[model samples]
Target chain A: MRAYGFRVPGGFHATHTYEAVEAAERIGYPVVMKIVSPDVVHKSDLGGVRLNISTAQGVRDAFDLMMLRINQRLPDARIEGIYVEKMVSKGLEIIIGMSRDPQFGPMLMFGLGGVFVEVMKDVTFYIAPITHDEAMQMLMSTRSYKMLVGARGQQGVDLKAIATGLQRISQLSTDFPQIAELDINPFIVGEFGTDPVAADVRMALQSPED
Target chain B: MLEPLLYPKTIAVVGASKKPGKVGHEILANLIKGGFTGKIIPVNPTADQVLDLPCYKSPVDCGESIDLSLIVVPNRAVVEAVKSSIKAGAGAIVVITAGFKEIGEEGAALEREVAEICVSHGVRLLGPNCLGLINTENRMNASFGGDIPMAGGVSVISQSGALCTAILDTAAGLNLGLAKLFSIGNKADVSEVDLLRVLGRDEQTKVIVGYLEDITSGDDFIKAATEASTIKPVIILKSGTTVAGLKAASSHTGVLAGADTAYGAAFMRSGVIRAENYEDLFDFATAFAIQPLPKGDRVLIITNAGGPGTMAADAVENAGMRVMSLDRNVATALKSKLPAAASVGNPIDVLGDADPDRYLAALEAAQEDDSVDAVIVILTPQAMTRPVETARAIVVGCQKGDKTVLASFMGGRGVLPGRDALAAAGLPQYYSPERAVAALKAMHDYAAWKRRPPRIVARFRVNTRRVERIITRCLRANRRQLG
Candidate 1:
């Protein structure tokens, strides 16, 4: 996504505790740390994620603790390395995703992330690649659109930036037929001019035999 | 590709029979009675004559080249019939035979074999287990679905033959005219996409209606439907919307991306008006065919009673349309013409006892108001209410304006004459306020869709080579699931 000009947080991979400290100092804290393994699909579920590590010593401790938790939980999970990244501030949480529909090639999905999406199922979809206007319409079609427009006197997030992000993802999905399903959950969006960051991403590819 | 199927110059009933109750005999009889101007040749080995037309032993023996062949033979002999028809220079084929594809694997294979022959010869095929088609433009009633429909602007396409008959019945009852109708059974060769493209280009059709059990290809449907919808309103009623074709995945989007949702998104993107039920399909078709598109969503209601006026207001709001307060000038104009007991707000209630003149006054004022995009005239039969006269008044006031009008004559026997009058004047009248409101909303949405900005998909400078390399490397390593 970053290759397609999407805003993503800076991060580095470190295999050892000393390397983790060095990478954190270079990237600057407060930062987030997580276990990087092909086996551990959901890092936070396995207690493999740590946040608000503001210093080099904090990064060292968080990395060791996350690894220890993952090893104890899975027992046989492969631990590739530790991922350290800059932490974005509190912002509105939105999810942007793509699922390659067998009939229609690629469908882009949008919703307010977390409980709103899980409980209410307030989501909308559009076939990609969509125009920027279509992306905006997709966002407004949801029941949670008022929340994005700043409900109860709260500040509204940068909606144009979100539309642009959606366009980029739509292009990405159209460009790569190998990508079967993708999700950028909690794409943290801040007020007005602030750029939204893709906090976490997951993508799946079509089976080789297919 | 479908020219011969829709406008055949010469048609051959391949299984034409002497027996009246037989499928072949009814189809041949329908062709003669429906007033098809072209030559109708019946092909049957056992009969020399059918319904006064000379019968040929086979299509190969028909002497003249056949533009279309309607086959209604037994299941086992369908393939041979199609082959002989194609051999006799038939441009298109409509197999009215049953027990193919809808039966089982053996039937499906036979259907495929027949389709393969049609494809190899470049001849279009309509169905192997379906009802035939109708074209009112040429006075051709090729189907055995009974009488030839009155020629009008609305055309229909349905997957189920029974639904086609029901639509035909409803259309006749409602006095809605039709241009062309097709029953695409099994869709072995020609599907909705092909018909959409053809009908979208057809000048005689103003509105296209469809009933589909399933679409053959989603991408092709979007392309064809989008093109058709841009030309005119394409209303469809699609059933079988269960959560089929879902894949187990790790994301919320993947879990929620079912067949129904994808179809919904596709329809939205392509600008197709989706009808919720059988009634909605005709209601929408009636509105689109008879009335001009509303320029905006603001609706003005004119009624003879308070309850129906209020009902119209509530229905308008519920349909996402605005029952806006009347413009000040229009309100002032209505006040002077109406009785003192009448209210001249959004629902300009011209009292329960008011007659045709009061409706004429309110409708005239609404016609000149630029802010009101549509008008709904509701009438309830009262002791002194003139249903027929008031309906005529509405026709006179609304006939010349850009603003479209829909009427809701809210009673059965009392409003029959008035509803017929409105129908004759090419104005859509509904049974109730809710139905009228639904139709008006459909027009509003289609107008808005037409007024939307041109679609421009942004194409960025993408790294195609890198994406190709990554995909190739993953597939080569047998790593289908990647992060």
Candidate 2:
């Protein structure tokens, strides 16, 4: 799920695994390569992720290294080959999630993305099928949102874009019954006025019976 | 006086037994032992006589009508007991049995049967599965539990029996009072919403506190709470906030929420002060019962030491209150009165070497300042700082000023003398700045909630047809499956 995230601009599960290298070459240089193995949830932790693969040879080498790393890291499971995609530049990272709660049902969570998600629980939630007003309210609830609004001469990220993205996930949850949770971390919210793109999308589907 | 319900004039233990360990014997013993000023009748069918009272075979044989009948029998037998109580002209019934809705599907059916019986007879049912209710106002101990609570101001309503006992035990140690306590278990018929609506109107109850794991009727609970909060503060310590907690609650009592965050947002919107922990729940309840509502969010800090005062200022700000800058004249007065080395700011730090007079002078000046809405006096142990005398001065200052006064005495045993002095004067004291700030914030929040226009959500009466369809679908899908 995490590996599928690096496949930027390509809708999830749209392209074949074997064509990923050719797709990256066709797309552009400075791409990222990650191992798409169900057994390895935290791919980055096990050295299954490699960034800045500028050439076709670089992609192949990184892919080979990732395969060897996964073999050593996860000996018992099957590997689903590798994923290759374009790399995104540094930008403000935000985390967005959808979780089903017993009390409130499905809820949309917004907070500062990346490792900060755990350390700083600076987050807010709005129940699914959220109104635009609720989506805006969720964005403003976090202290990090203040920072995103250009607190220190840093350009303010496009909040409307973030809200729209949140609304999409909320709608997705309502539409796709199998999608239990969707995590978009470090959704590189670009410099002021640019639409924020999902730098990574890790989605968990409910079991077939569920 | 609603004596029959709130302060029963006469009581009878319908299932009173000779067995020392049984609930029936314990209740009879509690009433007699607690000095209940009412006629007591022990009714037991199997025994000719019991508990030294005029033992009767049934409620019918108890001679005169009994005002309250406490039934502590098995689940299946409860329906008969309720019928007998109504037949005997008992005004109210306290049923202490477990095998009701709390047990499972079969028990829920039995609970509905019991409620139907109570409603038909026009008899008020306390619980089909409950620890029972107690009225401390007139010393009426109708609950089947063994413990007797201290009678005072704060009234508690808990959904869990064991939690009720815990609250009573905790209340006793804190020297808090109880006007009434209800353990509305299973809530098969009588619910928290009903009790809240009734208790909200009770004059004796200045503050209403609750420990609920699940809210059966969210709409009704919110309505009663919103109305009640207008008159008295309603403090709730809601459990089942986490995923695991919610699961545990479902197993304990069938409760499901769409999400926890929605509950949180609803709590805030409804003007209910949600306590983060058990201690805060009781602490805030105690503070609300004693302290006057703070007028505004602007607060003043006065301390014998600078560190604690500054810390308090930061905490106050964190609690959504502004630490007001002292008035120029007040700052000048404090500067002149204190040593030259002392900082003459909003937190008029009168150095560790300051005297009680200096502390009093700072507080007096701050109290009179129009900018300062409230005053937080910090007492840190030092070679010259007189904790007891300083506490007395602050208490006196509190009595004189319209502004609220809060104190934080930071040491251990050394702080106790000051704490005891504050307590004697009915002044609220905290062991740390964070606690003091939290208490002050709660006071401010309550005051704000009280002033706002009441937000009453129109009760959405269940659409029986729609609900029936959902239930039928659920039953057809699988009784064991829960989404």
TM-score of each: 0.95, 0.71
Among the numbered candidates, top lDDT falls to: 1
Question: How would you encode candidate 1's per-residue C-alpha lDDT over B1-483 as one tens digit per residue?
Answer: 688888889999999989988889888888888899898999999987888888898998978899999999998998899999998889999999999899999999999999999999999999978889999888888888989988999888899998988999999888899999999999999899999999999999999999998889988999999999999999999888633355676777887777588888888888899898988998899999988899898999988888888988999998889997678977887798888989888788888898899888888888888989899999999999888888899899886687888989989898899898888777888999999999998888888888899999988776777777877887777655544
Number of backbone-clashing residue pairs for each candidate, in the order shown? 0, 11
* Model 1 lDDT per residue over A106-151, tens place: 8899999999888999999999989999999999989899999998
Native contact fraction per model: 0.63, 0.06
- Poorest stretch of ten by lDDT in candidate 2 chain B: B248-257
lDDT of 2 by residue, A7-117 (tens): 244422113434666767677977777776656655677997787778777766676777777778788856766667667876788887776554444567788775556
Clashes of 2: 11
Separate DockQ for every predicted complex: 0.61, 0.08
Which ranges of candidate 1 are over 4 A from the true structure?
A: A17-29, A52-76, A207-209, B242-245, B462-473
